[model samples]
Target: MPNLPLTLGCWDYDRVQALMDGRVRPEGIDLTFLNMVVEETFFRMLRNREFDVSEMSMSSYLVSLTKPDRPFVAIPVFPSRFFRHSCIYVNADAGIDSPADLVGKRFGCPEYQMTAPVWIRGILSDHYGVPVDGPTYVTGGEEEPNRQEKVPLDLPPNFRVERIGPTDTLAQMLADGRIDAFHTARKPSTYDGVRVKRLFPDYVEVEKAYWRDTGIFPIMHVVAIRREVYEANRWIAMNLFQAFREAQRLTYEGLKETAALKGMLPWFNAHVEETFDTMGDDFWPYGVEPNRATLDTFLRYHHEQGLSPHKLSVDDMFAPETLEEFVI
Candidate 1:
């Protein structure tokens, strides 16, 4: 049989290149990998008709698998870990001590629609019962190009939000005490000067907290294959899974080395290493079966908050047969 052409896409160029170069091997599956950011990969896959490889977000991949027109099987990219959304940083001069102090304060964020904002609002609403409706909210960019559309939450009638430009500007505003608090989707280590605090430390204690609490892990990103190509060349999908699994394992085991050699931006490198370390053990298999409990919880949370338009079931998000083959 002739070797089929396979395209494996990823955002982290160093990690993907390491895997392809044989310096890191997850589970022995070799692939022709293509490195790209998650958004770019998704758009490319969606636009291409002839491509057989799958392109998807981790969340969407599972959702698609459960759909009747399941485009491609889901695969595990890495282990699960507590992923904290936007870090809430208050300038020392702001005099805001806790969640309650956020009222009437000017808050800076990357955006109201991004994942960090969603998680932050959810935490505040579900835990503190603070009304986000009345606070002044500031977005980072004046205009976000190709921003991912998110479902809006019920902001308190008293809440006000405005769009500021760039993360640096937002941070500077916080530093100058212009904004009372800034919510960033970036990990805590990414920022300095201001004291960064997790919004819901108790609930999101570890990476698996989402899985344990809601049984539905938020789909971060996924490899999506075109439908026709998936049907015609099933092996490519399977092979890709094997390759990723191997890559993930190698990446985890060599986390320290990978960190050292990659020489990423100091904050980003630290955050990536910490994340990999936390998820090294509970990683999912590179196949379609998602952590049902995690998905269920996420859907329930989103649905209750009116974040998700439709209530989706486990079967509505993943393929049973594909999942069965990859469960670790």
Candidate 2:
């Protein structure tokens, strides 16, 4: 008989397609997959512990560690990794031509403690000497009028974060020049106009330089198991970890299969080759040891940005079962 059944919540990204289709399955366990938008999934999972397993925001997960009754433990399976250089947008007329100019400026954010913004701000401060608290941050939805921070923050006195009313939004304020810039995980709908432009005109080049220097790809989301579920079934950690790795392996194979262009791009194959050359063969590695630098870097940023009440190490983040993988 099967050991038990579990519900797993995540986006239907290409990386997890095999698992979603039942082509890959964890040993001794059955999974009920919940395909949902990342925003809704994260909100529900973090706020209510609504799923047995789910993908969670790295920033929010760190903050959750501060609570006396932590509800979840994460595996090192990153479902989403993105560089945030392209997330920062500035008003064309704001005189913010470079990262250094962002100091003392007014910036809008959907949430100051979101993973993308945390990585962007940390990079800005560490790489360009911009103070992490340099800008006065206004928080609200990117397009909609009503939004709020998912969790409370414990910031230093110099850090200024103001929550906006239901009638206000970051995109509208940015277009109207009420804010000098806005940073978000997704592009604002107002981005089609001339009023707002990406802070880095050549963001690709900028991002490449950053990666070359730091070797950090910046993990946005990680897979987590409900604490009670994990405690009741400790062996499930490795089973789920191996299943995710197999799913990712299938994704890599699909990307390289050149019988026809797997994606819509004309240069899909060439792009894959170039990426391998630039980022190395195992670009999207999943294990804890392979991702230690990135995990450590993000943890440091979370602590320094006051998102985490105290500094937490990488070991504090992942399950002990996930800390090592068996070698052949």
Candidate 3:
């Protein structure tokens, strides 16, 4: 067996390790798992060059798309519910009530430009009639100076914004009463002397409604491979995708067991279970034929938001030949 170097980035490192160890063999491929993030960081310090391997991290993956050189055979992992962002938590001591009470309250977030914050602000502006535009709304990120950007013009004018550090800081801020409320992507188990009152559930609900209304699903993330890598080692790429598919299938069937084994914190476990229950069926089929509806929805949003230089066709995002193989 030729040892293959595969890098995986996820919150549940142990679960992935178990899968690779054949404790939970999905597709019979036992590729070696490399600690890419830690290794890459260390190598970069010594040689000032990045360690080259297939890198996978949901957060970093989006930034990867903006790179001109993209991979060709990245496989889409399981689809998680869209509600993974923009939760509203309040200090247990604080008497903050509904979304309307957010006025004059300080909030913390992971990033202002992140999808969750943007979506949450949009919902508050469009649905709840929150005035996000003025000085009353305060949000901050970890980055220095805590930059704030105007909500998209299409969104409500009153959407105030700020940046905060990571989710933990946000939780802490809420707990310490430094912020009356904080908005972040929190699992159900997150507790920092504060309690999550309401997350923007409407984010997922609205996404589903949009899909039903327009047959378009929001694109949260993508699995991309560099074109060059695909040409050189198509077999490995295909095998990798098969492994991912099998893993996803196993995850779906063994949800409860996987959750326990993954040692997901209580809040995360419930959140994962709920998400799987809701979006499990919509997970893309393993074979080629990418979910046209989902991709189209994502592209449409990307185009409308001017995020992409040009609208990408289905072929632009997926390899047609690989997809054809999966078609019945």
* Candidate 1 runs further than 4 Å off: 13-19, 22-30, 37-82, 93-95, 103-107, 111-113, 130-137, 140-169, 176-179, 187-191, 194-219, 231-235, 252-280, 283-290, 304-306, 326-328
- Candidate 3 is scored at a TM of 0.56
lDDT tens readout by residue for model 3, 110-203: 5443444444554555445654442233444322343333222222334455445434345455556666755554432445333545534455
Candidate 1 lDDT tens digits, 1-328:
4456555665664335565576644332344566665556655664343244544544434334434565565444432223543356666667676678777778776555454454566556655666656458876532242232222244333446665643446655665667777775554332454453443345346435544554434444445666666577555555566666666666555555642644546675676666556555545434444456555555554444344447666554433334556456
lDDT of 2 at 189: 82
C-alpha RMSD for every candidate = 6.7, 1.1, 7.4
Strongest candidate by TM-score: 2
- lDDT score at residue 39, model 2, on the 0-100 scale: 88
Better of 2 and 3 by TM-score: 2
lDDT string, candidate 2, 1-328, tens digits: 6567999999999999999999999998899999999889888998888999999998988888898888889999999999899999998889998999999999889988899999999999899998888999999888888777776777878789988778988888888888999889999888853788998878899999998998999999999999999999999988999999999999999988989999999999999998899999899989888889999898888878878767899988989989987789
Between candidates 1 and 2, the TM-score winner = 2
* Pairs that clash in candidate 2: none
Residue 39, model 1: Cα distance from true site in angstroms: 5.7
